[model samples]
Target: MPHAEVDGVRIAYLDEGEGDPILLIHGFASNKQVNWQYPGWVDLLVKDGRRVIALDNRGHGESEKFHDPEAYGAPLMAEDARNLLDYLEIPQADVMGYSMGARIAAFLTLNHPDRVRRAIFSGLGYGMVAGVGDPEPIAVALETDRIQDIRDRTGRAFRAFADQTGSDRQALAACMRSSRQKISEDDVGRIERPVLVAVGTEDEIAGSPHKLADLIPHAEVLEIPGRDHMVAVGDKVHKQGVLAFLNNIDA
Candidate 1:
């Protein structure tokens, strides 16, 4: 559980294994362990002979918490990821991100292409450009006194997840309010690195994997069968597809 002071926030991360590097970014309300370690992503990638680095984004996990909405945004958060790479002295690495993490990874790739060799967007697809619904309800739910009072289904689910993770609900609420900045279709199309857009077949929140893949010049799509947003992260199909996608890249 090493921590790096990037910009002004303290980002907590896990660095393991010892080959080519890959950086993992987690979703909203999730820490590095809950998103990558517990899900076997770190072990899977490490066993494949990769150096795995996963970070807890600002206001999540052990990272420094910021209650201000302005303190969070995909582009701003992407800076944290880039700074973490600089902190670790990794010139470039393959990057994978799930849900909110996917957005952060896209920004990292677009804003600092030199620092990312390949990119994987999981649990999010066309939603990257078309918008992933509204975050207001989710924010309200996180700030609500109790989950039982939440009426919106998506909001309730996010609130429940925040509670389950023992996250700082207020900080998460602020994050939800501002972190989802949609990337333009034009911007996504500009990414020159090889990309994989993987989303669950049943994921209503991720939009269409094909639609997103169609945007990136070198992008491909992987649809995790019989899985939805929440359960798709650790799915066998997802793990296999990602491994294959990573290995297929020529050194």
Candidate 2:
């Protein structure tokens, strides 16, 4: 339940274990617990002699809520992550983010490369290069009281997940209406840090992990076979790939 004051908002985060730090960012509508703790990511990283720091993004979990769409863009959200690192006085750490979190992490890596030692982008793919999906339908779904009223399949799924997570519907609506930023091929090519692009083989939302890996200069791809977006979060293949990646970094 610890919180950090960052950029005029209180961000809830978890700091556990001991060793090099790894900042974990959860996906849209998902809190740190559901996305990281429940999936055993905290434990896995901690057991590997690494410290894990995860935050509940703005408008989600116990963090401060903002009804303003201007406050929820990827750049602003990435600043929240950076501010958390600053608050903790962490000079640099490995940053790992999933889904929406991955987009935020990408912004962080692009804007403040010095603060990140390595980057892990999970549940993200060509969407990083191609651009984000439309947000209007999803925004409407968050505002709708009835989940069934959301006609778009993606909107319905996201709305249902938001309900399941007990998120602030209005705040999430604002978030959905905010900016959807995409990294350019030149920008991706400029990143020199070792990067890992992990995605589920069956994740339609992510497009293709290989496509994204091809954009980054020093990046590798890890495909979690037979897993979709939701299921891939806790997949053994993901855990192993991350551990192997970190181990190689230490070597």
Candidate 3:
């Protein structure tokens, strides 16, 4: 429930545990607790001697909300993470993000490689290369009076999830309107640090983890078998794979 002022907005974040730092960025419509805490990520990582830092992207959770579409983008959100790191006086730390947060993590690594050590991108696959899908339907769904009014299945699911999270509908609609920036193949290739691309085998939203792994210079893929996008976040395999990845890295 801690807050940090970044770019004129008060961003809510949770800084917990001890030892080496790991910044956790949650997916769209999810906050630090729902995405990382409820899933036992904080406990698992903390048990492994890691300091966990997670934040609610603008327009979600306890953070300040904005109705302007221009206020939300991968770059701007990534900057919020960077500014949070600055606020904490963390010069460098391991970065991990899920779904939308993964895209934002990529931009953070690309723009401020000096501030990142290893990168973990979860709930993302070839979509990072294929481009973020259309935001119009999702935006419209968020604005609708009822989830049943959303014709698109994905849009309905997102809208319902946002509602369950008690998110600001207008802010989320604006976020959907402006969060379409995609990372290019060239940009992926430019990342020099070790990267882990983790995705569920049944996640249609995430294209292919292998496809994305092939693009990064030093990257590997971890597939959570028999899980989809929604269910994969709390998978035990994901937690183990990440712990092993972190353990194997030379500190």
Q: Give per-residue CA lDDT, model 1, range 52-159, as digits (tens).
A: 999999999999999999999989999999999999999999999999999999999999999999999999999999899999999999999978999999999999
Tens-place lDDT per residue, model 2, 145-248, is: 88767789988988988989999999998988874677888888888889999999999888789988998989999999999987899999999999999999
TM-score of 2: 0.98
lDDT of 3 by residue, 48-80 (tens): 898899999999999999999999999999999
Ranking by lDDT: 1, 3, 2
lDDT on C-alpha atoms for all candidate structures: 0.95, 0.92, 0.93
Best by lDDT: 1
**Scored by Cα lDDT, where does model 2 land?**
0.92
The residue-level lDDT of candidate 3 at 45 comes to 89
Per-candidate TM-score against the hidden true structure: 0.99, 0.98, 0.98
- Residue 55 of model 3 has an lDDT of 97
Error of 2 at 13 (Å): 0.4
- Residue 212 local lDDT, model 2: 87
